[model samples]
Target: MNNKPVGRAPNFTNACIVMFGVNITWVLVVIWSLWGLLAAVFLGLGVNHLIERGRVWAAARQAASIRRGKRF
Candidate 1:
């Protein structure tokens, strides 16, 4: 088998963006007493993290299946 790399690079860029958003959200919502928006931001972050993990898991599974010459 060839030594081609599998999958894409690490998701540090998105992580950084998410962290920046959280910081800004915390600053604005805390000062303005907008607790609802803060909660929404955290919930959205949770969903985003889940989706990212799911994509990575799916890609890993697909890569493994490809290596084994089976249908993913």
Candidate 2:
């Protein structure tokens, strides 16, 4: 019995990458299958928040431009 690490029998990097890909795919499938409704709700909330923030930012910029008397 030898304790030296073999140079070839196992390709660690390939195995790791393959396993990671499968894991990610499985996670995506599970999410799509089981949590799509919840995911959509969250997605909607995120988009709403982003739109509201953009609106607020635009309003603020317009107010600033008016105060400055031109586009700054």
Q: Highest lDDT: which candidate?
A: 1
**lDDT for residue 67 in candidate 1, whole number 0-100:** 96
Please give, for residues 13-69, the per-residue lDDT of candidate 1 as tens digits.
888989988986676667456566667677667767998999999999999999999
Instruction: Compute each candidate's TM-score over C-alphas.
Output: 0.49, 0.49
Displacement of residue 20 (Cα, Å) in model 1 is 26
lDDT of 2 by residue, 1-72 (tens): 899887866659988979977975676667667878577566556766998999999999999998999974
In candidate 1, the residue pairs with backbone N, CA or C atoms under 3 Å apart (3 or more residues apart, or in different chains) clash, namely none
Q: What clash pairs does model 2 have?
A: none
How does model 1 fare in lDDT?
0.81
Question: What lDDT score is found at residue 20 in candidate 2?
Answer: 74
TM-score of 1: 0.49
Clash counts per candidate, in order, are: 0, 0
Q: CA lDDT, every prediction?
A: 0.81, 0.78
Model 2 scores a TM of 0.49
